[model samples]
Target: MMASIQKRPNGSWRARYRDDEGKEHARHFDRKIDGQRWLDGVTAGMVTGTYVSPAAGKVTLTAFYLIWAERQVWETGTRRAMDLSVRSCSFEGVELRALKRSHVESWIKAMSAAGLAPLTIHGRVRNVRSVLRAAVRDRALSVDPSEGVSLPRKRRADMAMDIPTPEDVRRLYDGAEDWFRPVVALAAFAGLRLGEVNGLQLADINFLPRTISVLRQVQRTPGMAIEIRSPKYGSERVIPVADSLLLILSAHVENVGVYGDDNWILPGRDGGPIWPRTIAYHWDRLTARLDLNGVRLHDLRHFYASGLIASGCDVVTVQRALGHRSASVTLNTYSHLWPNADDRTRSASQSLMDGALAIPADSLRTAGA
Candidate 1:
């Protein structure tokens, strides 16, 4: 072991040692003998193959986050969120080896105190934890410092049904230009997400069956090109179209300037897929022109589900139409929109109570006879 001891002007001794990789590490001691003893332990640890490289954990948090982000394969939007989390983090020069549960808790508390939305804080904290996890996987630490640390719970996004009423939908559709009318129609009537509506190809539509084959969707992930991936929750399902929607879609396919069967039904100027963003911008302007506020592109989907539930569609039917992962997911989102639950409960109770009170018709007749 090539280790050295130096005496400081303040009468403290310092021991320096190099690991197998020639990285130098040092410890301070009150006496020369203590410094020598510390070096001995390091040398012994190296010989026993129990050596932990301090270099891994000594990396700055910002540096490690950059390294970790490069290897991540999250979609563009999610990747951007992760990148923002790291960029906006306060632990600029914090050392990974010195990270502790207290540090994580302090960060969580600080974020909570800053009045950030619970979901945003949760995502940022999760991104930080995942970076530390990568360090652990790299053997920088024996235990995850983030393990068992309390993080803010993620509150679900507001999926409330602030839908455009039927009249509003008509006004918006009527205002849309020729190229965008079908897009509006699909969003308002078919409840297709922005990506799904943009990703539709002519072959995916079946006029005879009056259904849309939702095989893929356009997503803008971190890379240069927009990705075509399965729908949210990785669900691939067919959604039946209402007659009015089917007719509009049929007319669009026949008359509107759509890309060919193999291409995006709604193609951009360059003859490829139209960006969901561009479509959203159009919708934004249209909604503003029509004086519709607090309406999101996703609200169109909620409108479809709410309408269905009000019209007595069951949870499974809604789940399939929305392409959610499960019926529970559908119910959790729109259960409040279900109509007449109190009335249904009253009717059921009334029937049961009436049955309990009634005497058999034949029993009174037999007694009289």
Candidate 2:
């Protein structure tokens, strides 16, 4: 049924109506004709079932994002990255359902115009797509406006393959602080990611057999909240502990004591989880002291892979050690580090020549005959 207009004591005319979902809304008009005009429109919409309240049509982009962020299930670091991307987005206050493909395309263009990298633009688009997809699933919108949006082709940056020469690594380690040196050695020799290193517990170490178990990772969100999560794919694998790292771990445990039954191998000064930035800061200081190229802490993982390839370890073994889900990932990432097999063609050519040319010194003398 349609609603009727009523005059209030304040002398304003108000029209009341119920939506399809049985929710009531009232609109106040200054003129009786205006209220009657609105009531006529509402009565027509009710008869045709086409009435969409202004509030429903007017949901701001910011409100939709807040709802989306609340329901998101992501790791701390990933969530933080998404939040940052949303905060930096240009379409913050536009009506969400009113968004169009051109609007999304223009937003991407604006980001590129601001000199953001293609990968960064791609990430922002992905975040927007995720929110829009959720909106579609919730029936808030009939379709995702971000669908079919095209992104610029990403240009691959020059990867950091300039791994420290063995000499440089030795010098860096020697100059590192006593407590920090072990962390560097573990990263370089064992190829542990920063989160893995911070997540290590005493039980994860096998002092007797010299092995380390990779099971969990620790990450910090934007507000410095710590979250521990299972390794990618929940992979739990054992890596052989290098002799240098084992020795360092032993001494570190002895000096620090077990701390707690929780068994964290590396804790903060007051026995909480260690900060990832603290490790990177110390690593940078060590590199500066050694006057080496400013290698990223993650690059140490690359250094470990390069060392293995250089030392004749096959890609499969390296893949397992690094806990990569696929051998192709390992191969693609480290393929440039592998020596080129094309250089070996000369050796095969010499063997073929030796077999084909049967002429000796005596045969050469008889060639004129």
Candidate 3:
């Protein structure tokens, strides 16, 4: 659309143009050149398919989030976490158009100053970036201001994972109540997540084939009832049962009594599935009673992973056993546990040389003469 400049009655220049929607926007300037420059930029944006309506981004981040969040298909737990992340960033009142890199950097600094972990600060920033990115797609903002902002580095020690010792697992198992022993076994031996264990049913276990099928997980949100959902994306798998674990599960069934094939394998005291919070409460009490400090229930899964790596399982095998979505995920988490590639290469070369250079006993005796 062609922009027009005119001299206003007050001796100022007015630059006006009609947008694609036929809406007229006018700006007054002290000089004709300045008005022309503004009009040129606006038209250029339109020509480049980058035009954003001046009034579209008037809504604050908080207001836009309310509308945008309603349209998202996230699970209850995910939605709750997303809301918390958005609130933690403290950018609710900032308008989408007014959001700047400075605002994002300042929030990161404030969160760092408040002693929040670098991972947590990054998460909050990522959540806010999601909203801003959506605004860009909706034409509420011409660009996402959160892009390219520097984030705090996570400490190396914080990224390190520790596997629980066998003694630690045995102590927890022996000290735990009989009913809770199965929970410990499932995590430490089978590598089932706490949620997956909570969601297990008698039907999911195959005693004939000695395999356990992981199909679902129990998730909880504050002020909401527990929901059984599909296992975390690509986590649905069947793990082959080791004889030791099979024996433990067999004993558990005989001693605990099978309520029904459809019933929960580990039900609450009231015959319902165990709540995550309740499990956490019991686990904390048990750990403290045993004086096992710095040991988390999740560590049991790491123990299982370490075991797989120690047994010479290949990357793809371990990935499938642990229900990881990709081999890269398995490698990233447990690469340290695997033997060094250089060591393997050296050992293989030595074996090859030994076979190729073998000498007969007669030859050895002649050499001695």
Candidate 4:
């Protein structure tokens, strides 16, 4: 039923309505017109399915988050990140209905002032925005306060991808522990992400065809056991293994027999897939020992991509080889590494001119006089 307006004994008007849950909400207004207007708005909101019970708005952001988070279908790592992001801010105690754009903007300003990286601030802002959006969907909020909030921009230096040289990769390969060498080889030779490397299994490697099939990846969230999941969306692919990389894998297999049920190339303690943290432990030791500061294991993937670009591979080829979702992603990251259009055009013209001139042409000398 629609809201009812009544003339009160004190000459004011009372507007009252029963919510979907049969809870009554009432407001006293100075005039009958005001009460009717309020009732109309309440009716409209309810008709449009946008009505929020007066008490629902009283729930704090923290309380709402606790309720909303449990219903989300997120990966464990994603949930952990979201939890950390929520805890990083002070606005959790704010009531959902009381949250204002200024409050969100102020939170962003505080994070920026604290010298957080633009990416980190952006991530937290995104997480908070998601929660606020959910509140709107659940009718706890009329609007998302975090909408249209500007964030700090990433500097050029922060955006630059640091690709290690082949010599640096060779040094890293030589310095790594014998068991960890295959990790480096897979990353440097085949552009596999760390999780993919850790998820590698002997069955995924086809010795006859010399191809590495990236099918799955190992994921870990704090306080949870490592779990195996499919590769990052659209990143499942098969990379043709180079003979050298194949030799490294062969040697590793010979050194450590692959006899497990899962046939994990780099098995964890229980002879299942190795955890990413274990790989990180070995990687930290190797990098620290070699004094290769700031050179992460992911840099090897960049090194692999750069090598493919240097070898004249096209954007699409590199995209597929690197298991990127699309060529645009490949170009955006490695466009600078590709040869310039002007240089390629000039080289092609010069080669064509040389070939044409190579055909000796006898000069016409007045009928061979």
- How accurate locally, in lDDT, is each candidate? 0.77, 0.76, 0.85, 0.86
- The root-mean-square deviation over C-alpha atoms between each candidate and the true structure, in angstroms, is 7.6, 8.7, 4.8, 6.1
- Expressed as tens digits, the lDDT of each residue in 1-369 for candidate 3 is 867999999999999998878888899999999999999899887877667778777888888888999999877776887898788766778887788889888988999999998988878888889988988888788888889999999755325687789999999999998878988999999999989989888888898899999999987867777877887764899999788887887888789855534578775536667788778888999999999868889899999989988888899988888889899988878888888989799878767867898655468679968
Least well predicted 10-residue stretch by lDDT in candidate 1: 152-161
Compose the digit string of candidate 2's lDDT tens values, residues 1-369.
547789988999988877667778888988889988887886775565544465654776668778778876665666677777777767767776577888888989998889998888998889878877766665455467788888987753336355766787778778877667667777889888888888888888887888999999877666556777876545568998677788888888888655445777765535666777778778888787777756666777888988888888998989988888788988868877777777458656656766899546566679899
Residue pairs in steric clash, candidate 4? none
Measured on C-alpha atoms, candidate 2 has an lDDT of: 0.76
| lDDT by residue for model 4 (1-369), tens | 557989989999999989887888999999999988988888888888777777889999889999999998876677888988888877889888788999889989999999998989989999988998898899998888888989999755325778888888999999987888889999999999999998888888888998999999998866678888878754889888798898899999999766468888886867677888899988988989989978999999999998988888888889988988788878777787878889899878767876987533333344466
In terms of lDDT, model 4 sits at 0.86
TM of each candidate vs. truth: 0.68, 0.67, 0.87, 0.83
Runs off by more than 4 Å, candidate 4: 18-24, 43-51, 157-159, 233-235, 259-261, 309-369
- Which candidate tops TM-score? 3
Q: Order of all candidates by TM-score, from best down to worst?
A: 3, 4, 1, 2
Candidate 4's TM-score:
0.83
Q: Looking at model 2, which ten-residue stretch has the lowest summed lDDT? A: 155-164
| Off by more than 4 A, model 3 | 20-22, 47-50, 157-159, 259-261, 325-328, 349-369
Per-residue lDDT for 1-369 in model 1, tens only? 679999999999989988777778998999899998888877776676444577776888788778777887765666777778777677747887777777777877888899997777877888877877777666565456667877776644344247668887777788887778888777777778888887888888888889888888887665566777777667778889888887787787677757744666786646678887788888888778878856777877877887888788999998998889899888778877776668799868767866997756567689977
Indicate which candidate wins on lDDT.
4
Error of 4 at 92 (Å): 1.0
Output the TM-score of candidate 2.
0.67
